[model samples]
Target: MAAKEKLSGNIIQRSAIFLENIGKRFAAGIEELGYVMVLFVECVYWVLTGFRRKQPVRVAAVFKEVREIGVNALLIVSVLCLAVGVMLSIQGIATLKQFGQELWVVDLVAQSVTREFAPLIVGILVAGRSGSAITARIGTMNESQELDALRVIGINPVRHLAAPVLVGMMISVPLLTIVGDFMGIMGSALFTGTEIDMPLDVYIQRTFEALKPDDIHQGLIKASVFAIIIALVGVSNGFQVGSGAEGVGRSTTRSVVLSISCIVVADMIFTYFLNIGTLT
Candidate 1:
């Protein structure tokens, strides 16, 4: 009887500890979210009002970062989107073939690429690529006390470092999504042309017929939101980095994971709201 009573107490204690840990993590997550919002507002303020300040945002610096973050990433993004497009065409044909609807693969590829896959792929790519880079750069500066040096020189880190990144991401991601959408649709068209002997013109006409302006615009809107999420998450994680190289490494990993997770969640929210809007 005593043994059973002691076991019951242990189980109760373990359950209590588990609940406590969960509550602590929930609180931390909320606090971190607040910090990210503050950082985003600061970054936005600097971008919008920097021209009126004594020290305007340097055009050369912003442009340099844009080239580094956006131009350098283009080839890889293009290749991945092309591959995804081809795969989608192949699988779509296979699935719809049983129903004598293999031709519907054109519609599938066009709508899915324009409305969903292209933006999502670009968002994830940027989150993994530029997001980690931003975190590691800022984190390295933190370790070397460069952030402090900038502060001592009367420069805000968010204005000097993060705003440029945010601008670049916002500009580049939507353009990338557009490019990805085109490449993805073209890939599908090419695959269908070769595999099923469908003429390229017919496939393109079918694709154009299947997609509407709203479908394309939805992807652009999603890409814009994803850019903000990726940039803020990356910059926020970088600012939160601890001391040393190990800290930078950990922060970079966290930035990628957090940015991707946030992008997915934001995408879900956008989808829900957009669906409601469409229904109404």
Candidate 2:
């Protein structure tokens, strides 16, 4: 009887511990969400008001961020989009040929790349690259007490650090998405012209015919939203970093993971609502 009672007690203890951990995680997530929202609002406010202040808009900082976030990422974005385009054409050609509708591959590649793949691929890549870099940079500053020094000097860290990043990302991500879209389409064109024996001009004309203004607009909008999410998550993680190098590393990893997850969720929401009006 005593052994059975002890077993029951052990089970209950384990259950309690599991529940406690879950509750803690839930609370932390809620707190982090609140922090991100507040920071986003504050950064927007600063951007709107910064011009009227003594400092005005930080053009130099914005330029630096643009260089770091956008220009640095161009080559990788091009390569990935090109690869995706080639793969899409190959698969699309194989499947459409089975139906004797190989010409439809043009429409498939163009529409899919423009409307879905390019923006999403760029967003995920930026989240992994620039997002983690932002988090690590700020976390290291936090660890080294540089943020505290700024506070001591009466500088608003959010205004000084985050506003420029937000603006830079907003500008850069959409432009990068445009580049990615072009690269993806070019990749499909290359494959079709060589392997499928389609003429270059004919392929280009078909692709242009298959694309719509709304498709491009929707992709740009999604890219902007993803940029905001990545910047907010990255800056938030940076501010929340703990006391050491380990804390910086942890925050960087979390920033990348969270930014990517949020980008996907936001993309789905945007796609659903944007398509809902046409659902008839």
Tens digit of lDDT per residue, candidate 2, span 1-280? 9999999999999999999999999999899889989999999988888788874558898889999999999999999999999999999999999999988889998888887899999999999999999999999998999999989997888988998899999999999999999999899999988887999899999988989999899999999999999999999999999878999999999999999999999999999998898886
lDDT of 1: 0.90
Model 1 lDDT per residue over 39-71, tens place: 888888887888988666677777887687678
Best prediction by TM-score: 2
Name the best candidate (by lDDT): 2
Q: Estimate every model's Cα lDDT from 0 to 1.
A: 0.90, 0.92
- TM-score between model 1 and native: 0.95
